[model samples]
Target: MHLRKVYTIARHEYTVTVRRPGFIVLTATVPVLGLVVAVLVLVAGRGLLAQVDTLVGAMEKPIGVVDKSGYFSPVLPAFADDFQRYEDETEVYRAVDEGRLQAAIVIPPDYVQTGRVYVYSPQNVFQRVSLEDSHRLRAFLAVHLSRPWVPEEVLVRLSEPLVTLTPVASRQETAGPWASFTQVLVPYMVAILLVISVFASSGYLIQGLAEEKENRLVEIIISSVTPMEWFVGKVVGLGAAGLTQMGIWMLTSLALSGGAMLALVAVSPIPWYRWGLFLLYYALGYALYAVLQAGLGALGTSTRETQQIAGLASVVAFVPFMLSGLVFTVPDAPLVRGLSYFPLTAPTMMIFRLAVFSVPTVDVVVSLTLLVVSIPVAGWIGAKLFRLGILFYGKRPSLAEIWYALRSA
Candidate 1:
């Protein structure tokens, strides 16, 4: 293998990518939009969160009172400072209907004397407060009142468990609700981006290789360089061009956020490390596909057939991409975990699963090692095919032709 010729092939591939307006745009577009969206999301999310906190605090304020059994009439004020006093439920209803009060309570006319209690809200007349809300109010009233009102033990009983939320373990804790939503979404978008990228890079490597063959330039390169050098060069060269496009995007995002938002996001220790995980998968996936794509490219006479073949693999590789949202609800399911190790589906599926579920560290290590091992093994097969396919172009060689090419190589 001639190192110089390999570098030459690598350089040639790089130049071709740099000169393509389409490739340049595809690589840069998403990161730019992500940065813009990131800023908007941060600002809007903060406003929404801040607004939610304030509203939750306000919603807790007493808008009306309930006096079941007439026992609460004298002690109600101790529990409800802002709750409007009323002679009857009708007055409370009038206050609610006229917008004078946000909510009301009914004492069942025997609440003070009996165990029965009833409350009212315009929002949901029959709806009971959630356990958390009920517990908090009970705790608050229990502390403020002089008389025994809304018995703490009774309130605790009234408030059922609000949610039976069980968490799925992942190495990274989801950055709260909004942050988790953001983390899951980022990968889906990136999957599409990388899918496009795998094709653009590998597809070009093929087109360039095919061009050299058709022009008899490949024969000349083969004279000075081993097929391996030519193949490796083209892959590295084109891959770099792709990375350059990604680099520009990285820079653009840092600039847009003035680095602070990125810093804030990164400090969260969740989504911040996704880029590292994403890159690890990207390299593995790219390596595996690059050889197959190159082999196919060498066999095709026209660019159209080459693209179609490459596109099919991309579509197949992207199949796991659709499962991203589903994993959020069932990340630890056997089906989802199985897909993470399946080569075609692994990159996108496994990464999202890793992000959502607390995948065993052993599992991640094993899966990654498996994918890494597959890369060169895949390349070897593709190289044999590429060696034979380069000279056998036109009308897409039949399965027989591909078979013969492999044997001869």
Candidate 2:
């Protein structure tokens, strides 16, 4: 392995990537655009509720609410700030027909506990509803919570609604705390970006390799450096490029949303230590995936074949993200727990669960250690595959051939 050649490859990658105006614009400005969009959504959402009276006037017509309990349930008191009242659900429909209201609501007696709130509006016509519905529901729950009779169990029940972790014992999981888990969403985006990055870099790796092979330039580069040095350096340089782009995007995103940014800093509910854990896992995760991408790149005789291999790896990387919603809802389900221990899916699923709730220290230690150990092991295996894959081309090789590559010097 020649340091000189490695440095040269890295320098070339950095320069080529930075000098492309398209890459520069995308790398630098994308974060700003993302941040701006986020801020606009938050600001506009907050502002939309500012002028309640004006909003009331803007509604097309009156809507009705039915309590169905024979008692007059006070008109959502806030709804009074918006809609004119109608006699009943039927009358609300009539008023809608008469161009008097947009929709109607029916609050069944068990609406809160049952999660069965009903809405009625003209069929096949678009119906607009008021904002703060979530606020209204949450406020309603909070007030109900203040009542003397609501049990602690019911409150916790509503929060997760699934998993229902018993908190059997307390242990200091390296996962840290809740906010630390939000970074799971961070890697989710990372997974997609890095997968794309791997795709992009693998192209850079293989096409550069193959183009060299085809144009008779492979010998020129190899004469100056060993294949292993060149391969390792190219992978490192491009990975650095990916992380730099991702970091800039992350900081840019945070900077753009000033309010949330401040709130996150001030009231960060997640534990700080988990950041150490996140970095640990992120590095391991990225290394494991990037090396695989490198091996895939080294194997392909052509660019098209490289993509097929890269796409397969991308799907493998994305399995956790595809099931993120489930991971959020059922963090401790046997399947979730099982996959989280499995090397390929653990980073996303385990980290996400670690964020939302307390996991055992053993689980945390075992999972993180596995990923960390796997990184170099996988990279070495990939490097072997890569080193051998470089020379074997023309016909697609067998699993025996791939296995032989893995064992190659």
Candidate 3:
């Protein structure tokens, strides 16, 4: 394997791919869509808030009151403007009908025994009471009734009590049931991004291989550089392209958020050291899948056929994502551990585990070791398949023939 030849192939592949219209469009699509959605949300949110404010302002109009219950006969100075005093229900009804009051309320003289209050408002075809008006009336009653006996500070507390919420874990080191939504969400996002990049890059590799084989370019490519070198070069070039896509996406997100997301990451539960492990797993995972994708591309008779086979592999990679609920609930379960050690699922599964819990050092080391060890083994199998299958045409080889080729290799 010549370094110069491999470098030349890699450079050619990279340049050709980046220049392709599909690559350019696909790379830009995510950022463009994200920006569009964000803008729409901001605009819609502002419009909605404005509408709410307008409705609230309308509701704030003076509500005529006929408080015969005697508890709130003399409206407090603080609420006098909000609750305008009236002589009886007849005057309140006239005020509401004339649009002078948005709503009115009358308390019965038997209020202490029956606790009944009459709410009066103009009824339309579909009448709905204003929530703001009801809340205002309730607050007015609570304060005036308690004012004679309760302290000012106590009245305030009775009107609006302060409640603090705290999440407590059974143990100091464990947060399994007590994990925050952000903690689980951040890791899941990372896993999805990595999985998408890996498969997208691998897809490019397979498409290129299939097209080259269709054009009989592989014959000439192999003659100039060994199949293994060609495979390595394509994987490197395509993987770099995938990284470029991811970088653009991340930079776009950071730019749109004004680096707020970076600040969020800084305070996230994931440790700094785990980021290095993340990169290692991503690279190894890409290499392992690239090997499988390359072999599938070389082995199939058509691009469509090759893609269909690769799609099955793509499903396998998403197994960890599908089991995410289980991961968060039972990170140390046998099934979760089994997936973490499995080569195809390990990268994403370990990534998920890292975010939700403090994964054991032994588990991390073992999972990483398995991923590290799988690439070469996959590559060797891929090489044998590529060597024999690339030259064959007309019909796909049978399992028996494939076994012989592996044996020969």
Q: Which stretches of candidate 3 lie over 4 Å from their true place?
A: 34-49, 52-162, 169-179
Model 2 ranges with Cα > 4 A deviation? 28-53, 56-215, 259-262, 265-268, 393-395
Structural similarity to truth (TM-score) of each candidate: 0.65, 0.63, 0.77
Better of 1 and 3 by TM-score: 3
What is the clash count of model 3? Answer: 0
Cα lDDT tens digits, model 3, 34-75, are: 889888979888988897785565566788889887888777
Name the lDDT value of residue 4 in candidate 2.
81
Model 3, residue 235: displacement in angstroms?
1.1
Candidate number of the best lDDT: 3
Q: Kindly report the root-mean-square deviation of model 3 from the true structure over all alpha carbons.
A: 5.3
lDDT of 3 at 115: 64
RMSD of each: 6.8, 8.8, 5.3
Model 2 C-alpha RMSD vs. true structure (Å) is: 8.8
lDDT of 1 by residue, 1-409 (tens): 6788788889988998788787767766877688778878898889898967855664665556555443445544334555555777787877777766656656475533453445565554223555226654454334333235657555444343354454566543444545556566666655665776686676666567667767777677677778788778887887777667756766776687688546544544345456787778877887777766776666667667667766666676777767766677888778777777777677877667655556777667767888888877767766766677665646556788778766775
The CA lDDT of each predicted structure is 0.66, 0.62, 0.78
CA-RMSD of model 1: 6.8
- As for TM-score, the candidate ahead, 1 or 2, is 1
Error of 3 at 75 (Å): 9.6
Q: Which is the leading candidate under TM-score?
A: 3
